[model samples]
Target chain A: MTKTELFNQIKTKKSYLCVGLDTDIKKIPKHLLSSEDPVFEFNKAIIDATSDLCVSYKPNIAFYEAMGPKGWQSLAKTLEYIPKDCFSIADAKRGDIGNTSSLYARAFFDKSASGMSFDSITVAPYMGKDSVSPFLEFENKWVILLALTSNEGGKDFQNLELAEGTEVYKKVLEVSKNWGDSERLMYVVGATRAEKLREIRAIVPDSFLLVPGVGAQGGSLFEVSKYGMNATCGLLVNSSRGIIYASSGEDFAEKAREEAQKIQTEMAEYLDQFLK
Target chain B: MTKTELFNQIKTKKSYLCVGLDTDIKKIPKHLLSSEDPVFEFNKAIIDATSDLCVSYKPNIAFYEAMGPKGWQSLAKTLEYIPKDCFSIADAKRGDIGNTSSLYARAFFDKSASGMSFDSITVAPYMGKDSVSPFLEFENKWVILLALTSNEGGKDFQNLELAEGTEVYKKVLEVSKNWGDSERLMYVVGATRAEKLREIRAIVPDSFLLVPGVGAQGGSLFEVSKYGMNATCGLLVNSSRGIIYASSGEDFAEKAREEAQKIQTEMAEYLDQFLK
Candidate 1:
């Protein structure tokens, strides 16, 4: 999906929400375990319930990978089930050398080759530009580079003090601008550091930012919009556990929609206040 | 596999060679493509041939993942076929948040869960301590963190001036020491920067380093040993194309063995000089 198309989806939906499909087997309703593929069934319900409430769906790849080949089949099905108008993200934090990285690009972006093609894939920038440049080759496929992650580990290496008071992730943001433009590039700015969005916006104002760690991770949606919102509402605030795991009963999907609706309603108000 | 077990294998085989199973569909011989599971067939042949000379097999995950579910099945079978004594390295280079990282750990380390129990898996250290520490939870499993990569883009953020003389990778080597010890932790030092091995050794003297980019990527095996070797012969120098794709014709396995033997012979000589 093009940046303009994604922004248009947000404008029409009045929500910049990205529902994260961080599904786990043990945590899901026990009744579904008898099914051939529990992960896909769970995801299908979630997508069906909240497709209109959110602009994108981000499936954390680790959950499906844990289930092995059957899990991959489920992920492919889940990808196909998502409404085409709604952007899909393979939250597979994959990056490698030039050639190997290109293969990874094919794994996620070339649906014919890998059985799944996501609009974007979250990439860790430890290996630098070439590791990321491969994913950009596929038209309309975005590379969401990991910048200030939400996890406690994000403090370890990402926040390292470089010369001239620059942090490692900011340096990542600064130097990576040469590799690709805002049209094809995005940054994973954890919602925990909502304040830092101001600094991030100053560096790459137009590029989209995939903000994980809202709700269950204790990040406020309002603060994210207040500090991170750009002209195009350049923030994809992701909520994974809080939304998907909202209920353990048979009405799990219904409850999930309720949670997504609540967040979407709040987000629409943010769009109105920030944009208007 | 434990560090002591790995060191013993190096002593027993007198070779620290790691065969990289970067099996690509387009690159493998046409004869194998006709097989029901060509990827597995190709990996089985390579493993059967070089199982004696190489101490470990590092299957670059991209090659298998690009083929989807069947590819993962091939990887599982290949993992089962590897000799019990020989170490297995899933060159997946995967790392995420704590919960997600544990899932990745289970995907590789917990055979009961994912049907593949690699001895160690390569992890990108971008997310920091918590992201890496989860993999260390599994007994005897290892996390080989990428420090200085071989690709030209390694110069981008890895060589950044973090301080007066400290570069990003060195800082990764320094800070990561706090997360896990040499017993459970190693680093990926690309062979292109063989000179940097000496400096890397100063920071991480005892921890084993998985050095890739040998013949195909223009990294000399001798330089890697001279600077990177320690008391335990602490380096698993990998050669993917030079050995696996040595002969694309009918005698592919034989040619692969011949190429592996050539490297093994050189490695044995290094072991004698370094250990004796």
Candidate 2:
């Protein structure tokens, strides 16, 4: 989807929420296990319940992949099930050399090739331009490059200070600015480091930030909003465990919607205060 | 395979050569297109011809994945076809958060999970220790972290100067040292930076190094062998296009063997000088 279309969705939904589908088959309701495709069934319920409450759905591909070919089948089915109006992200942190990356682009963007085309796929920038540019070839699809990640190990290299006083990920954004525009490129800035959003926003003010590490990771949605929101409300604050795994009972999907609605309500207030 | 088993394979074959299965459908022989699975057929032929000449087979996962589900099937078949003694490296540069990384580890290291089990996987360290440690959970499986890549874009972050006068990749090696030892871990130091191998070897002396960009990318085997060799002949120099795509006609696999044989012959001499 285009930037303008995404902005319109954010406004219409009154939220910049991107519900994470980190669905673990083992963690889902045991009753669902009797079904042929439990992961897909679970995701269908979650999407059905919370589609109106969020602007996007980010499926962490690893969860599906851990289950094998059947998992891939579920992932493809889930990708097909997502509403076209709601942006879909295959949070597959994939990147490699120029040729290999082009194939990865095909695997994610060319549905005809991989049987799944996401609106965007998260990428790692360690390999530089060749690793990232291939995903940009699919017009309108996005490449969400890993910048400042949420995990503890993110400090290992991402936070390295340079002689010029720039952290590694900031320099990553700076160097990568030459690769693609805000229209086709987004950045993954962890919500746990909400304070860094202000600095990250200064570098790429218009680009959307897929902020993971919210609720369960102890990041406040309000802090993520205050520092990260742009004129277009370009902050996709994600909540996976806090929402999807809220209740593993038969009402799991309903409980997920409740948590999503709670987040959406707060997001609406921030959208009004920040965008008004 | 363990380090001793890998070293034995090197001595048994008299080569640390890693044949890259970068099988491009368009580049394969036209007759193979008639087969049920062209990429797998091609890989089967390549493996049948050169299994003894090389110590390892590094299938660039993107090449297979670009073809979709059938691609994965071909990969599984090819993995099953490789001789039991030969090491298999999934050249899938995958890394994510701790939980996600474990799933990825299962996807590659556990055959029952992903229908393919590789001895090692090349990982990019941009996300840091958590993204890598999970992959090390699989006993005897390896995590070959990307340190200094050979692509022009490799200079972007891997070569960045830190406040402590250490290059980014060196810091990656330093910080990652605490995560896993030389036994379960290795580093990918591109063949183009032959001189840098000495410095890298100093940091992780006992660790293996997967070196790509040997022939097609203009990296010399002699220089790579000179600076990179350890007491265990610690190098798996990879040559993809130069080997697999050696010919496009019916004689493709035969020519692949010939090219591999030539490299193996040279590698034998290097082994004699370095290991003797």
Best by DockQ: 1
Q: Which portions of model 1 miss their true places by more than 4 Å?
A: A191-194, B191-195
lDDT of 2 by residue, A44-142 (tens): 999999999999999998888777667778888999999999999989899898988998888888988889889999999999998899899888999
Please estimate how well model 2 matches the true structure, expressed as its whole-model Cα lDDT.
Answer: 0.89
TM-score of each: 0.98, 0.98
lDDT of 2 by residue, B1-276 (tens): 999999999999999999999888878999999989888899999999999999999999887777766778888899999998998999989999999999989889888778888999999898888999899889899999998898888888888889989889889888887888877888888854556877888898888888888999889899889888898998898988898889988999999999999999999999988762
Give the per-prediction TM-score of chain B: 0.97, 0.97
True contacts kept of 2: 0.75
Tens digits of per-residue lDDT, candidate 1, B79-160, equal: 9999989989999999999999999998998888888899999999999988999999999888999998989888888888
Model 2: lDDT of residue B183: 79
Per-residue CA lDDT of model 1 for A74-111, tens digit only, reads 89999999999898999999999999999999999998
**Residue pairs in collision within model 1:** none
